[model samples]
Structure formats: structure tokens, C-alpha cells
Target: MVASKRNRVLAGMMLAIGFAALRSAPAAEVAAVLRAPDFKLSDQYGQSLSIQYPRESACVLIFADQRGSSQVEGWVRPLYSRYQGRVTISGVAELSSVPSALRTMIQGIFKKTIQFPVMLDWTGRVSRQHEYRGKAAAVVIVDPQGLILHRETGKAAVEALERCYEVLDGLVRTEDETPPTAPQDGPAVEQAQRQSRQNGAGGAVRQSDQAKK
Candidate 1:
């Protein structure tokens, strides 16, 4: 009789715990969205670049520390090949740990080695604002209005890459499916076709370069 009473009490406790979890689930789901922070920083080439919200195209920011820098190309090359025009991709290097004296040398090295612009975060202000992971590369996808839609940090694993691609694919498809409010003239149509061809050709060149490497 006593054992039966104890089991009943245990069951009641479990039921109450389950009810509490269910009650909290909706609150967790309704958490506020995260927005990307805007900042201006000089690239390796000493060119100024700024990230402003509500941009014309979606943006991808790749953040990496010295250790994580090696993994960046894995994410950048493929992303550039696939979404060059449809998305704006940028690289942010977290360099707060570097000595002040070596900063210029580091910038020069980046300029010589990297074909594209790499924004140098000397004080790590931008990286911290973006919640960058120091141990691995952090890839953030932001919508036109600057809301962070997806974030992946770590080695560019196949599954993570695929998830990023799915988000980009959906965004591009939605944009393509939207009906234009006004009819385009001949030049506009021709320009779009030319851009598409250019993108395809660029992707081919990148793939070939990767194969050669």
C-alpha cells in the first residue's frame, strides 16, 4: 500500500514538470529576432566598406580569427561562385590579439594573398557585435533589412554548407517569383540576361581554379 502511494506521488511530480515545460515552450519560440550590427572598416586594400541595414541584396558575413582563418576559403569560394550577384559576401578578420607593431605587416600579407577585400577588425569591435566564435569561422546570413536569418560557426561541414545553401536558395527563389510592378524595356531585359551569363561563367572559372588547386 505504501509503495503504491509513493509511485502515485512520483507520477504526479512528472506530470507537473511536463506541464511546466509545455507552458514555457511558446515563450521561447517568441523570443525577439537578432539584427546584424553595422560598422565601417578598411579592407586589406585600404578601401572603406560599410554595412548598412535594409540593403538592396542579402548579405553574408564570414568572421574568422587567426586559427579559424584557414577554414574561410572553404565557405567563401563556394558561396561566391553560387551567389555572387544575388548576395553580397564579405570577410571580417578578428585581429585584436595581434600586436600593434605587426598590424601593417598583417594587412600587407592579406592584400598580397587574398584576391578579394578582407576587412580587418583591429579592435574586435565588429566581431563582438556579431557574436563571432573565436575558435572557428562564423558565417552569418542577414536579410535585406539586416535581420540575422541563419548563423553557422565551425568547420565548413557538408551539412552546414547545405543548410546555408537552402536558405540562400529560398531567398533567391522568392525574389525571382515576385512579379515586377512595371514592364522592363529591352535594355533592362538584355542586361539581366547578360548578368546571368556572366555569373555562370564566373562560377565555371572558380570551379576550374579550385580543381587546379
Candidate 2:
């Protein structure tokens, strides 16, 4: 009888804990001023870094698992280069399921190919704090005041990222003539086709080239 009573009490406590978690808003949406929490991890070169160190105008934290590396080259790599000094782009690898050596290998591939700072998040503490999910996730765009201007999830479209840069740049512009914030006029569908051929996405390359002429 005592055992049964103890079991009932345990179950009630579990239910209460679950309910509290459910009722709480996720960590990501919580707004705050001052410095964002710092995450320290080993980069590809085996050097340690935190978000607070090496201050820049902006920062991008990309939380990528193994699978997302495939797409990182075609898309993510260019952005890192484009925003190099202006924005510090840091990649965090979700290494829970991966071996340490294999994680290092994956980081090597990215470094050799993209040459950006990619960190390893073995405990997933950073991921959960920033509310990361799935294969590719990112956040942590801080303004000059050290306030986060954009904390987003998932890989947003290239156009969306472009718009973000434009707005941020505009904010710092001192000229009397400021450029109008244009709507998302994406690469013309036909133009993308032509460029895709030149860059070689590996389908209809020659045919697209002939069509472009």
C-alpha cells in the first residue's frame, strides 16, 4: 500500500513538472538588453572562441548538423565571404551523434572548402539556449548596441538575407540620400537559369547557355 501511494505521488510530480515546462515560453522569444549569452567552442583550427570575443559590427551563429554541410557550400559559403569583416559568421556543429574524429573531418571539409570558423557543440547546450532545431539552424545578429536585431530559425532564402544586410547597412549610412528599402526583387527567373548554367549546377548546362544567347 505504501509503495502504491509513493508511485502516485511520483506520477503527480512528473505531471506538474511537465505542465510547468509546457506553460513556459521557449528561451528564444525572450527579449533582453545587454550582452547575449556567450558560447565557447573549438573551431576547425582547434582554437577556442566565444561570441563576446573579437567584436564585430554583426554576428551570425549557424548551428548545422552533419547533413547541412552539403548545401553550405553553394549558399552559406558566399555569405561568409561577402560579410567577412562586417559580420562574424560562426558555425556550430551538432556533434552529439557524431564521433570526435569524424566531427573534426567534417569541420576540415568545411574549412578547406569555405574557410570559415566552424565550432563544435557536443552538449547541445547552445542549441537549446538559442532554440535551434533540425539539420540547419541559426541566430544571433547583434546591432552596434550589442542588442540582437534578428534571432531567426532555419535557413532563410538568399533574398531574405540580402534584404537584412541592406537594412542594416542603411541604418549606418550618414549620407543625406538614403537608398529606398526595395522589396524582394529576386534574381530574375531567367537570369538565375543563365547564371546557374555558367556556375554549373549540373543540369542543362550547355542547353541553358545556348538558350541565354
Give the top-scoring candidate (lDDT).
Answer: 1
lDDT of 2 by residue, 1-213 (tens): 999999999999999999999876332432354455666887777889887733535666666666654544443566665665666666777767767667667667756875657777877777666656747555555654456555544445565566556644653443235589865555696787788777776556777888999
lDDT of 1 by residue, 1-213 (tens): 999999999999999999999875421111137988888999999999999998888899999999999999999989999998999999999999999999999999998999899999999999999878597788988888888888887777787788889888988777678666896779889999999999999999999999999
Give TM per candidate: 0.70, 0.53
In the predicted model 1, the residue pairs found to clash are: none
Q: Which segments of candidate 2 are over 4 A away from where they belong?
A: 1-35, 53-56, 99-114, 170-213
Q: lDDT for each of the candidates?
A: 0.87, 0.63
Error of 2 at 116 (Å): 2.8
Worst 10 residues of 1 by lDDT: 24-33
Counting clashing residue pairs in each candidate, in order, gives 0, 0
